[model samples]
Target chain A: MKRNSIIVVLLALVCSLSLVFLSGCATDQTVKSNTIKGDANISTMETAKSKAESVALEEDTLKEAALKAKREQERLMAEAAAFKEKDIHFDFDRYDLTSDARKILGEIASWLSKQNGWEITIQGHCDNRGTGEYNLALGERRAETAKSYLMSLGIAEGRIDTISYGEEMPLDPANNEVAWAKNRRDHFLVVSKK
Target chain B: MRKIIALLIFSVVFWCSSAACGKVYIDINSPAFQKFPLAIPEFKDLGNMKPGENLSAWFADQLSSTLKITGFFKMISQDAFLEDQSRAGITVEEIDFSNWSSIGSDFLVKGGFSYDGKNLAVEFRLFDAIEGKLITGKKYWGKSEDKKAMVLKFADETLLALTGKGGVFDTKIAFVGKEGSSSEIYTINFDGSDPVKVTTYKSLSLSPQWSQDGAKIAFTSYKAGNPDCYVIDVASGTTQKISSFRGLNLPASWSLDGKKILMVLSKDGNEDIYIKHLDSGSLQRLTNDRAIDVSPTWSTDGKKIAFVSNRSGSPQIFVMDSEGKNVRRLTFEGSYNSSPCWSPDGTKIAYEGSSNGCFQIFSVGEDGNNLMQLTFEEGGGESPSWSPDGRYLVFSSKKNDREMVCIINANGSDLRVLPDIKGVKSSHSPSWSQHLNLY
Candidate 1:
């Protein structure tokens, strides 16, 4: 009976020690889960902040693209208007370029330089004073003179084409010096743009 | 007395025989030539069926007008005719020669027609009023719609008998008719009748030249946004692009054999004349000058080419061989000479030269000897195209501020504006076609 009492006391003491160890493990697990939860909350907050920043960045990129496209459109339109702004005139039955004509052609060359992927056509016209056959040749000469001048000014030859109207299509149909001067001209047109 | 009468009769017989032996009745080349007086009585209605359409008066009027347009015949007034219209005869055996000869009729035309509303048979006879001999006779069978054609055929025969050359009655003149900003090719009869629209390309089409066979017309058009050379089949109205070189593709003339076309091209950096072979599609550049070279015309013999060039510090005509060699300058008197046209005989070249601040038609011998100015009108003449017989020229001129097409004799006489083409503001660039074989 004395030995039985001693064994029971030892068993109770061992059971108390095991219960303390299990409680310590459960406290460690609870501490780990709480730490994990806190870390998750921080991660969620960081994710939200990054998402907001990304949305704002995307909007900024889209606005910038729209602004760039608008600018490109405006530039193209301006270039087109400038390219067709004026026509160079010639004297009676003459194909030689004058000083004013040269200046205008120089301006045309500059506009063409900016307009890559575009093509131009130079329509040569003449007054009704000369014969149609001769005027046809004269118109061609005027167009060629302008084209040659433009090519000399660094414009590509392939980008330029020419046609002669030969007094057939006149800007002014009146029979006077003013109308004739206006009719004898080199008109520029934008044939294509890509 | 007997011997003298026999001698006179022998001489008269000789003269009549000579007149019948292909002797031309009219010498039109004479500078002092006078218009031949002609008379035509009302045609006889030989039809046994019911009378129709006043065919007698219509035939007489048609013949008179057709002959008068040649500037060769002076029609005698029907009121002055002594022959009774109701009993007049068409056959030489049944006519009184004194009636025609006394009325100053050197030639007389008698016509008779039988019409059944669906078909018509007509007979015509040309007689020398003095000798009362039938010079030519023709009988035609056709429908009522062929009345004009039959009259034209008889007129051509009469002209052939008198002038030793056929009339251009069946030919057409191709010209550029302009309205607003567009110009198109239009064709009209030689007498300015039956105006036909040839091209419907509502763009600038210029320099129309007829093929030798009259089956096609080659011209330049801006319809494709470039001056491209196109040949249109006249009958079918189908167009084909023959040359579309990057630069000026103006067709000027076709070869005599219809195997080649002469065109002005600027593909080699400037305007130059080049001949394109129709069969091989091979191009042979005939001119290589830095100056403007254009308006090429092929000679009838196909041995030479005449073109206009501004190489001598002014525009002038130039002649070269078919192979593009032996270039010689022509037209030294003018500062501006262009639109070189070779005569059908290849003996003379006609062009427009600037004179007195306006262009006038001028012609020079192929050897450059006879440089004659053919026009001195206030508005001036340009684009001289030769008739098929080489006896007349057709050109464009401005009269009363309106552009009109005019025809003139080769001797620079009888200049008259063709009747106006209706509904067109102006007409220019007239190109005369060869005699079309319509029969």
Candidate 2:
């Protein structure tokens, strides 16, 4: 019975030692979790402050930003509208310049002569006629014809680049004479400006 | 031992029972052809692989549909078949011909496939059901990924055995499709299945023409902000720019030997045709005319070239020697004629021209004597490319506010859309391929 009591005391010592080690590990985990919670609280406070500040400035910032965006949009629209207003039209299946086309191009030449440090891309278009392959070449010929006239009016050759749309993209997606006339035109777009 | 003896006795009995039935030679060229009643049962998977049934059915469906489109065979409905499965009979010694004969099938095609985890081996046999004898049998072995190619190989052989020449069923058709506001290149099989995307350059790609070997395709793409000529390998999907001149590098045609590519470059301020030596990248300018000279097509013999030129004040078809000599205009009636495609047999040229007020497909002889219009619908047809067999033409038709590819008989009788092709609602500029031995 004395030997049994001694054995029980040793078992109790081992159990107590294991409990101490386990509790030590649990304490360390608790300290780490508390540190994480503290960091989360700081972050939440910072985010709340930022959120409050943004809410306080929302009305004035939004109105000012909207007004500035509208003005910039209008400026871009006016610039694009200027180029669209002066598109040179062509007759059906013909690339030669008409008297009216020549006159409009003369006005365009004067306007181009006044501008500086700007490059224009001459997009040749076709009126949904003929094969895509043939129309492509024909459209290039049209753009070349226009570019040569511009060169004759003293516009730098480097300022003009040409491309052909070949009945793929159209100004009006209609199958009528009026739309075809509008589509068969040399559209001008400002590609680069100082 | 007992099973072997029983099998031998059964085979001998069936052989003697089905010996003599008259043979019939079908003339596919006959205007009023009685389609041969053909039955294709589901293929069997001898190895019992997981996807055996699915692959077998897929191959059988491809074969049946190809045979049906030949216009010479009446593919009997599978429901009319007495044997729902092939029953492991790939050899003449094992087949019970009476079972097929009783079902009223004139010809029968049965096949079996074995998948060994890494590779597939398919065997096909064409039998005269009435005569109870095999006409031809073939076996194809390849990687599992090449299952379609193996099936096509068998189909090609079967077609050759039936008709004196094989069909272009295994070939691909390259065309342009409108995707997300940009045009890209796409390829589809002749049977109208497996539409593969060939290009993703989100720009305008047009006029895709296949090389003579059917290995590469040359087309024009505005990828680098200029219309440049590019060649793409069909198998690897790798693209290389062939020409990037100052203006207009458009693909025109590929020579029969694939050593020369003809294109139109406007570098000289006028669109003119030039031949580029593919190996050395040397160029030979063919036309120096002030008028527009474009859309060049080479004859099958590579001795002559047919093209479109506006030398006559309007676009018309013209022919010249390979070296740009002996030029002759071919078409005079049409106000606008372009896109000339030479037939494979070197007998005729098919082109598109304005008729009345719309473009129509026309076929003219080599000497420019007979000019016959092939399409008459209000919807115009353009880009008439010939099949490898020279018996059909595939072109694009803009009818009823829809753009689709149309395949028509060379004689202009049968007009139909590609049966199972999808995403073709906005496809155009089709080019048919030759009989390629890719597999």
| Best-fitting candidate, scored by TM-score | 1
Task: Give fnat of each prediction, in order.
Answer: 0.44, 0.26
Pull out the clashing pairs in model 1: none
Model 2 spans with C-alpha error above 4 angstroms: A1-80, A98-100, A116-119, A152-156, A172-182, A191-194, B1-37, B43-59, B79-106, B111-123, B128-133, B139-147, B400-402, B413-425
B325 Cα displacement, candidate 1 (Å): 1.7
lDDT of 1 by residue, B394-424 (tens): 9988764357889988888878787776667
Give, for candidate 1 chain A, the lowest lDDT window spanning 10 residues.
A76-85
Which lDDT tens digits does candidate 2 get at residues B1-439?
A: 0011111111222221112222235556566756678888878777857652467687789788777765567787888877636454656777677777888898888887876775567777778888877766666666666666666666666666666566777677888886535788888877777788888887888889999889899999888988999999988888899999888898878887788999999998899999999999999999999888888999999999999888888889999999999999888887888889999899899999888878889999999988889998677798899999987888987754445787877777667676434543477789999876444
* Deviating ranges (above 4 Å) for candidate 1: A1-72, A82-85, A114-119, A190-192, B1-19, B49-51, B79-82, B92-103, B116-118, B130-133, B399-402, B416-424
Which candidate achieves the best DockQ against the true structure?
Answer: 1
The alpha-carbon deviation from the true structure for residue A116 of candidate 1, after best TM-score superposition, in angstroms, is 4.0
Please list all clashing residue pairs in model 2, or write none if there are none: none
Model 2, span A29-74: residue lDDT tens? 9999999999999999999999998987895688888888778656
How much is the lDDT of residue B302 in candidate 1?
Answer: 90
